[model samples]
Target: MVRILTSFVWLLICFSCAPKEESIVQQMEAKGPIPHPTEAPDQWLLAHIDVETTGLLPGYHEMIDIGIVMTTLEGTFIDSLFLRIQPAHPERLSPGARAVNAFDAHKWAQLGALNRSAAVDSIISFHKRAAGDNHVLMVAYNSHFDSAFLDHLFRSANKTWREMYYYFILDIPSMAWGLGLKDLNSAWIMDRYQVKDEPHIADQHTGITGAMVNVRIYKALLQYRQDLLAAVPVP
Candidate 1:
């Protein structure tokens, strides 16, 4: 009888300690909607992203730096990310871009190995955590070029970004057009919004700074939308 009771107790403990099995989606649903990442400036958490490339093309040119800043939805800057990379050689620095960023090719050569794949992984991981399962709007001054470059990199990486299904990339220039406004240059947005003290220079081609500029631009655009909505009279 004592042995039988012990066996039953062990059975109870085993059942109680059993791990529950659920699909990834089921687990996500149980956790409720993941918090949406703040890609634009607003009253809540916001993320500003930028990148500096060796040239116009991402894969062929290489990314030298990546920058991001997090702020409140109210436009108050909070945290920031400024990472420098060492890309492979033969990276042609445009005379125009070189004039601003002033990165000495010889100096940059000392940084270390070029890990573009690792950089992309970092972006994907960060986006996944920040945006959760919800799609986050990826805004760029010219998303066409930036987006295409990103696509090329991801496709070359042997990882499919489609698994996430949580990316919403929008070009600010295009957004302006969609709003029936002419294409606004980054400088124009900066000047109009008076976002001089935000971070980064538009001409320097510093990826980090460029991303920060995009964030500010995104905020300004949002404000523009609000103004438009306010201006229109209700039917």
Candidate 2:
């Protein structure tokens, strides 16, 4: 009888710890339809995310900043959040990397940047509120680079909650290629769109501004794609 009770308790613990299998479609169905049908159109969360790190090398350098902008599929701006973290290993931050990001370890130290754990928790909370039941579709300039660090951030934050975000990300450069836009840097893209912002300038290149620029680039590329598709003759 004692052995059976112990085994039952263990089973309960295991079951409670497992990840719940629920897709976005099921979640939307449970919540019913969205209020605005014509206003925002499609439902998924469009997140233009950017990360600034100590250096380009993954694992070797820590992420110092994170920025995300949540928008509707129709390109309506919803909300944005920016988070910064202080590295435990600041010695690894090379002068070139620091100069590129305009980050000084001593300055951030004096300013009292958020520790890794706190920054991670805050970012997670912000994402949950922004995403809600809608699927999170991330758009980044160079997804592979950012994803490497973000993957580390999630995995390092809490192993249990690593599944909190989307598995895949969309690259803005790839979108531009598909849309037949010029394969140029974000500054050039912004120039083509006449956005009137010098976001790529080294001093102005914080994660927040970077994310905003990324979103602008995404919207422009999407518009180009739509125009091309509409112009195509039906087979």
Candidate 3:
């Protein structure tokens, strides 16, 4: 009987693990393998996105703030967006996180009640409008964390973020390593590019500031890659 029960449970788990059906948007977003760009290099757009949450893990945490800064191959700020949402699960806020983000009790209540679905809808719409046909190279400082949270949020909203994102996420930390900048970060990029108006707090502490830092970092990385390529030997 125990063996039979174990087999039944295993079968149930396998059923649960089956991949979800792909949505129509997801189908449309799929692309074939892209060929390498010519020496001139195709224009690459970068979107610096940041999110301040009540806790560390996505699906488990509540997002308090969100920001996005968009730039082109040349690093010019084409557009930006910032929004603060009332935390859905106020109790989720950790003391350390609150202190870092400075979202005290008073500050929290000031944002007033927010419609979570409406907020997500508005942002998703904005993201679509901003992105258009232009492929966005997302440049979050720690994209693993931010992307996980965003994915969780979209899942919670009954929407697949991968569909909206076109199934591509160019995380900054990984990009940093690609540029031989392992252990380097937003502050390093700022100093490398001599960017003015440094923030007093950590990038993750303030969503807007974090987004701006990501934008700057993308620019620095692009310039770094260009210089590196220029230094390469040719036949």
TM-score of 3: 0.74
The predictions' CA RMSDs to the true structure, in order, are 13.2, 7.3, 5.2
The estimated TM-scores of all candidates read: 0.61, 0.75, 0.74
Clashes of 3: 0
Which model, 1 or 3, shows the larger TM-score? 3
TM-score winner: 2
Candidate 2 residue-wise lDDT, 1-235, digit = tens: 9999999999998775443333323433454334443454464777888888888888888888888899987667999998777877778887877777877777777767788888878877887888786666677888888888876665454432233445557788877766556555755556666765535555567778878877777777666667778999999
| Model 2 C-alpha lDDT versus the unseen true structure | 0.72
- 136-175: candidate 3 lDDT, tens digit per residue: 6666777788888777666655566655453567777787
- Per-residue error for 170 in candidate 1, Å, reads 0.3
Query: How many angstroms is residue 35 displaced in model 3 relative to the true structure, after the best TM-score fit?
Result: 8.3
Which number leads on lDDT? 2
Q: What is the overall TM-score of model 1 with all chains considered together? A: 0.61
Worst 10 residues of 3 by lDDT: 34-43
